[model samples]
Target: MTTTALHHRIDGPDGAPVLVLGPSLGTDLHLFDAQVDALADRYRIVRFDLPGHGQSPSPAGPYTMRGLADDVVALLDRLGMDRVHYAGVSIGGAIGQQVALDHPERVLSLAAMASAARFADPESWPKRAATVREKGPDAMVASRPGTWYVPSFSDTDEARRLLSMLRATTAEGYAGCCEAISGFDVRDRLAEVRVPVLAVAGAEDPATPPQMVRIIADSAAVGRFEVIEDAAHLLNVEQSEQVNGLLAEHLADAVAGSRHG
Candidate 1:
C-alpha cells in the first residue's frame, strides 16, 4: 500500500483501475476491509479516512457534505485518476452521490450503501450529534446502538470495535460531519445522476431503511437497490460477506461495460 501526506492510501495493483472507497462518519478507511480483500486481486483500491476522521488532519469545521465531496475529487486529481468506481457507506455514500452529481466525468460507477439522499430531521439527530461532539461516540452507543447496529449484532467483538471507533472520533471532525448531514438534502437532484448506480440498504436498517433505498434507487434512471439480510445501518461491516458479494457482482458487470465501451 502507498499513501500520500494527505492521508489517502492506495493499495493493490498499480495497473488496475481504481476503486475509491469512502467510510461512514467517524470511521476511517478501515470500513472497507471486507471489500478491499475481495477486490484486491482485480482492482486497485483507494481508501482514505476523511480529513480528521483517521490519520487525516482535522481542520476545524462547520463542514458540509458537498465540501467532503470536493475533498474526494481533490484526492482523485492528486492521484491523476480521470475516473474511478466509487463506493461509500452511510455519510460516505452521501459524499459519493455529491461527487458523481457534481463531477460526472470523474465517476465511472456509483455504489451507495446504507445511506439516504436527505438526512433525517435535525431534531432527531441533534442530540446525538451534540453528545458525540461533546462526549464522543461512546455515549451515543450506550444510548442508541440502534442508529449504527441492530440489537443482536451489538453483542459481538466486531460490534464493540466498530462502536469504539465511532466513540473515538475527534470532536471537530465528528461535529462538522454531523452538521453536514443535518442539512443534507439530495432528493431533487437524484435524476441528475446519469451514471449507473447500485444502492444497497440493510434489511433491518432503521436509519436508512429499505424503503429509503428504494426512493434513492427509483430517483436515478439507471439504478438498482439490494437489501442485505439481517444487517442494520452498518451493513458493510456487520454483513460484510453479503455486501462484498453484491459489490463484486456489480463491479464485474461495470468493468465489463467499461471495457466494451
Candidate 2:
C-alpha cells in the first residue's frame, strides 16, 4: 500500500520479453531462484521482494491484494516496462490475479502456481497474523513446514533453505501479508481475466488445494490447470524441473497465442 520502492533484480537477456515473478508471503524473491536460473537465458526475468520482506522497506500499514498489484505496476512503470508475462505462488499468485484485473494493460499472460482465486478457509489467518505480530517471524516459520510442504520434502536441504528464507522475513511484513490473505476473495472476477492463464497446484497442498486452482482455470476465458505430482504448497521449489517445464510451456503458448491474436 506504500509507494516506497521495492527491492528488485532484473536479469536475463536485454530486450527479451519480460517475465515478472512475484513471491509468496513469508518468502522473498529467492522463491523464484531456480526458475530465474533456468529461464534467464531465454527471457528477461524481473523479480522483487515484497514490501517489508527481504531488502524492501516496510510499509506504514497493512496491504491489500490490489495494493500490492499496484506496486508492481508502478515498478514496471519505473522500469519502462509496459507489459510483461506474470507468475506467482500463494499470495504472489493472488497479486497476479489482481494485476490481471486492476491493470490488464500491463500483463501479457499469467501463471498462478499453488494459488487459488480465493482462500476457501480464511479463519486461521487472523490468529496467524497475531502470532507473528506478537512472537515474530519464528512463530510463522515454525508452523509452516506442514502447510507449506509435504512431510517428505520438508526435511530436504532445499526445504531447510527455504525455511531459512521464511525465518529471515520481518514480522511486520509477514503479518501484513497474512492480513491480506485473511480477507482475499476474487472468484467473482476470475472470468474477467482475458489473458492466457495457467493455474498450477500441488496435489498434496492442503493450504490451497488443486480444486481451488482448478476454479481459476475453469473460470478464466482462456486458462489451463496443471497439478505437479507428489508436491505441496511450494511446488515450484519442490518439483522445480516439472514446475519450470510447465511455466516454460505456458509462456511459450501464451507468446504464440499473442502473436496469432
lDDT for residue 45 in candidate 1, whole number 0-100: 95
Compared with the true structure, what per-residue lDDT tens digits does model 1 show for residues 23-128? 9887888878888888898899999887668787777766788888888888888888888999999898999999989999888889999888986675556566
Best by TM-score: 2
Model 1 worst lDDT run, 10 consecutive residues: 1-10
Best by lDDT: 2
Error of 1 at 32 (Å): 1.1
Q: Residue 70 lDDT in model 2?
A: 87
In the order shown, what is each candidate's alpha-carbon RMSD? 3.1, 1.1
Cα deviation at 102, candidate 1, in Å, is 0.6
Which residues of candidate 2, in runs, are more than 4 Å off? Answer: none
Error of 2 at 238 (Å): 0.2
CA lDDT, candidate 2, residue 134: 89
